[model samples]
Target: MTMINPAGIPHGYNTPIPSEILTADRVETRIGTLEFTDGFPSDDTAAKVFDHLDFLRAVEVFLQCVPAASMEGLRAGLLDIGCDAAHKMVIADRLLDSNPLFLTGNTDTVYALAMLDLHRDGPTVVQIPPGCGPGTVNDAWFRFVTDMGAPGPDRGAGGNYLIVPPEYEGEIPDGYFVSHSPSYTNLLALRGFVVEGKTDVAKAMFEDGVKIYPLSAADARPEMEFSSFSGKEFNTIHANDRTFYNEMADVIRREPIDVIDPETRGLLASIGIRKDRAFAPDEQMCGTLADAAAVGNATARSIVFQTRDKRAYFYEDRKWKTGFVGGDYRWLDGDGRDGRNMDARTMFFYQATLNTPAMALEMVGVGSQYALTERDASGAFLQGSHSYRLTLPSGVPAKDFWSVIVYDPQTRSELQTGQPLPSRSSENNRTELVYNDDGSIDLTFSPEPPSEHRGNWIQTVPSKSWYAILRLYGPLKPWFDKTWKPHDIERI
Candidate 1:
């Protein structure tokens, strides 16, 4: 049959138009059917597509802005603990244990942390104590600002460092390592290594030598007060629900306009989360946002627990995976040839905190290295009900030390059990670990007591799932060269 157009040209006098270029009267998709009239979508179809588009943007927003939301959550947690000012520091005086809900925090180092607001204080001065381990400053979006101690310009001798805001054009002062940050709020974190399996020396070093104050009051700085958050029950993990969007929105409002790129700004704006306007979504939008959050959370969890990317694995046959995929701190693919590695960024930020170049491209025998595994040798999720054993080869390949920590799959924080620390460290020993005859170490995990190697057993809660991370402080050449491999956790 021939169809007549409004223009009245005789059947368009041309070859038959391909149906691909035209909208059909009815089309079916994952979101049901869409109806159209002469290439124009029906009202119902338009509504469906609009709702679906919002859902997609929200999910992507959750993935891309996790770094920002996580940072905000940390800030709020610290504020609740009275570490509100730069002068007030939260120090893990007894070493970080399972009590505090910190993301992937190990039980190996004494941590001293302070939150800095560049907006309130134009520039801040941080005095790192000598013998400080890895110290980092991350900006509002969790981007690296600077390193202060061992991996920093100070080279472990400790030095005074100045951190300035993005727009600060103040007079540059000499005799201090200075770095400018693009965001208003920054996280100042310093780790103090345990000296000979005790935290007293590291705690004293941080309490007596470390100082932080606004650059304006260089003459007279406020007295630094340390609060021990070691055994405290606190939460720093971001929400996986719709409340996550609010956290991101708060960060956007507090930070500068250019803190995020235009594309990201537009994405957030589409979801009624702009920096300038109130994020008051309508009832319908609210429901959509909730659904989006659930799906986004599931997607992120999948990326962390069962990543499909081959690059995430450390070896061809090993389940040990590096969280910092692509070995680029910036998440650039193909060395920036292919844009950002979205999966890599989502994987790292979802499970960890404190992003810096040292996390990725550290030299051998310098920075730390980590390998995470949630699966057994048979490729099943690590279940708390079952018993498992992980054996490390004789030469563990850590110049400074090595440790393994268990974490709750739900919170991505330390797993809480009868043990307070939930880890076995070679140097920062919370408990003794029995070594094999050939110097190999066998670590056990189970809900019940293991018959032997009780000292090496890290308890797991029944009916709960968990994962483990192997940390190598001062990683040596064997680690980088892949000569020393970790055995997969085998079900016993």
Candidate 2:
């Protein structure tokens, strides 16, 4: 049976599709039918479209995974995988939307909290002790506010306050503890201290029925306050990864913070810590330290932290760092002296945006694609033979950084040859790159560049199928707008 669309284009696949399968438009037609509907309203129709596009995209992706001549079985295998990928995307997207932190910046903090809940046994209390310094208070506030409930993609319940010196219990001291409801969203309780002195504080905490005494606010610091809370593990998943930092900032900027207490709320406002925006600290050192620790622990064979591209891929031989506290200064030391460190700090505010539960779901998409192409197949490329070329179209849109990376298709990790991987960006300037008259650029890949094109050429050994990833940092308008498309690799 031959099926043709209104435009007379053939739609049927060269390989026979199951009879139960309907065309994307639901119009019954024979083989080769190609109908273009305005849009798909049903999941079935959308699935068909996604499946078709995914198959086409997989063809190009798979070509980079294995040798072209031996791709027949591999191609079939990928087709099955692509179908699954389509379904996964749909399910994942749905999961993301339903998550309380989906479009919010609280994702990573929430995820880390969830991980802690999963790994650690027993009930967790997010304590805001009295007398914590500004930084410690801020850190505790962010963590508690972000993660305090069921610990899933959805915003869990907020913590309940065990406010020291209950409102009815006479004049509160200058130092008091505040607790927020763990069950409600945006719940907070402020404990005040009317009387001064450690003994007085301790008595008030005990007699007034408080679990912990607030540290002296004047002497409070992140390290000092965090130290007091022993035994409970602290997971810093958002601090180190640049991608998470950027995303968190975006989420914070969007969600409005509702502070029921006027004095505390005003205090937050005076410091420029707006409820709808990110923390006031110009540099989010603690979060950065946390991120570095996570990356360090996760680091495997190689860890490449790309600030410009806002992506870090780590491969480690052993279990990497997970929960992080203190030692933040060590990570900063490696960050150059240039104002770059400050810039990284500004980037930290955005971590909440990228580390959400929905973001975890998105990882499903990236991971599946990564795993599929990295598997070793009979048709996989050998050590060296073919040359690959990727051409960046004009007007590539990226703000902070952009780069293309080659991954060992079989390993799915960064290809670690003696030489640094091939990359072109503002960060790694190829002075010898030959720019076209129009100002566009071309990158050539081969084991050996033609003598004249050596400057713009990257080496690729024969027979090894490799995958390419185009990374875009900062605002993604240009890439999202389709004004720019990732370079396509072609064999010479």
Candidate 3:
């Protein structure tokens, strides 16, 4: 007796069947069985298959660029709240609340966020605060337009800067650091350090210092309005469905066609989005696009948290990770020979917004740095009910400031608990943080505040999983040299 396949085929692998009996009518089929391998029945069927594949390919490209798309959506949302180009949104109260307004937003500093549409407002002027850490100017695509503070032209002292819109051939003004923007819409974000956790001092700086308006209306410009968004719930993440494609279409229609690469433009065209044309997809095409968007979203999420490449991990023995897994901001491999790394792009966008070459470069004493982790030292995903501890060595590597912020793994936004801001930082208010003899400080994560180290603890919720980001505002040489490394979180 011999074991036989359920399909009534011969038991041995070497057995052969008669070709005549292989006809479709005589063969039993299952879910994955190929009913017809000869080819598609008609040209229409072949064309439809090709179109769906192309649609999916375009979706892959779209998902890879979600960071830029998400930044655009945030700008739009800000505009919706207040249409004035000169207005700014700042955290009015203690710290930034657990809102989906921005990804990995820091509560350690008072943020003055300005959204501008130069196409409508013409040339705009931005006033930067001196000594403010890292302020950034990004365009519609979230491409880095300029940096403010120590590394910027302002050099940590306040200065007036002018930004001319695309296609603006106006007179180049004198005595001002000028930048020509490549996109019509722009984002101006200023991070002001607070004194001893007194946000009022930082908030005042924004109110008295920051200004933005059309150059022509400088004298009569409306006073810069500051809106406090503390404790508010809003969305800043881009949609992962058909709405995402619509947002990209809107950006293409509003900005110059050259803002994105030609290859990207072609991909958009394949999906029925072209500059200066109505982006109307038929019902069948829309269905295919929706399915593509779902897959695209899943792809980016997988890259963000489950990346298997060894290069993604920070150390051989720790779970600390970097969003730019390749160590280069531009996603270039160490050899610099391989083409763009799509997984790196996906990781960045899924976790944060904005893109700039400065982030990719290694600055000796200045510039920003980031570390992300979703797991504990035991190589297990973080659980809300579990308490954990992390230790920051005596000589923390941040020349400016360091913050450990907890974020919801799903939204990539601040993790909401009883506390508004689920973070602890080496800023003004945390001055009393007890440090060890060697200067190492311990931080705790638990639903209930720690019995002793209250200042060094971040609150966690009991029902939600979370991740964290360690931001070094002005990363020092030790960080770059790998001489100073923060210990991973361990279960208490």
Candidate 4:
């Protein structure tokens, strides 16, 4: 007996099994009736199926590109605030005011942010104030352009910076530090530190030192307009819904065709988002795009909150964590192979906007440091309704200032409670904060301010859940050496 396949191919030197015989008979019968076609099985239907699959592949690519798109939306939102490219916004009052449109906002330092529209303007000039710490100029795609402040090219002494747009080959002027941007739009964000929490003085320094204008109108440039976004409510985060695709499409139309890689542009082209062309997707395509956006948004959120990387945690026994999982600014995994680290890119852009080498640089005396924690000391998610306390040991490591800011888990922005910015700081302005005899500071987080130490408490909303970040401006050696550590948020 022999075993045979459906095609009647015999299995050597054996009696044919019943199952094999049935399979061979079925295959033989099917083959006898089989009809061969030159192309698709049905009239053009197979081609349509392939086309649909290609569309899905394009969607996945677009999903991976969400961070770039998100950066563009943020640029647009910033521009919308001032409604003018020449004008920029700055925080005026020392008091932390209303919610900022930007995500993972810090109530620690005074900020002066501007959205530059260089698509039609050609080039823009920005002047930074001397003594300002680390700040960044990021393109619309959130890619780092350059650094400003002490660790930056200016070396803590502020100077004029010329930001030339993409493909600009005009006259190269001398006397100004130059940085060429890859996108038509860029975010020029600066942080001003107040000594001993004198916010008014810091705000004044920024007002007098900072200026922005196009190179063409250098002499006749309008005075830099300063608007106070503090103590006011506004949104700066880009929508993560289907409209996010539209934002990306807008970026495509405005930016140079070569700004992004040809591969990504081709993916957008496949979905009818070519430069200068109307991106009017048909009903069927729109439905697919919406579904893709939903999945992309969810994927980004999961990456930020429930990160798979164990490296996100800093201590083995404690729950203290870092937002940058891999620890490297570039998010490289020791082996720098792939393009940019996509997971790191997604996590940063999803929560915050700026990018710079200074962010990862362990500057001993001058620069910023950050620690983020989502879970309590017991490895449980933080809830606003529950009271928690964190203790910062004396010699807090921040030479300039330090702050603890609570944020909404969903928005990743400042947690909006009765207080515009739910934070406590060690600045001189926060003179009310009480410290222990040993010099350690205790911080309380709860829906209601703690009974005895109201000044040491940060308020949280009752029904909402939140996370918090500890920002150290002008970080010191103890921070880098890990000699000084902050206790985890302990539920009380």
Model 1 segments beyond 4 Å from truth?
1-18
For residues 226-296, could you state the per-residue lDDT of candidate 1 as single tens digits? 88998988888899999988888898889998998999999999999888888898999889889999999
With candidate 2 superimposed using the best TM-score fit, by how many Å does residue 253's alpha carbon deviate from the native? 37
lDDT of each: 0.90, 0.31, 0.77, 0.76
Question: lDDT for model 2, on a 0 to 1 scale?
Answer: 0.31
For the record, the alpha-carbon RMSD of candidate 1 to the native fold, in angstroms, is: 2.3
Tens digit per residue, CA lDDT, model 3, 210-237: 7777888878987777777666667767
Candidate 2 residues 1-492, lDDT tens each? Answer: 346565544455455545455435535433233444532345665555544443333222212111111112211222232312111100111111111211111100101111111011112223433331111111112323332222221122222322221122333334222432221112112222212211234223322322221222223422211011111222222222333333333322333333124543453344333456555334444343344334432331122122332222111221111111111211132334532232232222222212112111222111111101111122233234566555666655654334555555333334434334344443344355676777677776666667676667656656565545455433244443445554335555
By summed lDDT, the worst window of 10 consecutive residues in model 1 runs over 1-10
Cα shift from native, residue 107, model 2 (Å):
25
Which tens-of-lDDT digit does each residue in 338-375 have in candidate 4? 44567766777788767777767777777778888888
Which of candidates 3 and 4 reaches a greater lDDT?
Answer: 3
TM-score of each predicted structure versus truth: 0.96, 0.30, 0.87, 0.87
**Model 4 global lDDT (CA atoms, 0 to 1):** 0.76
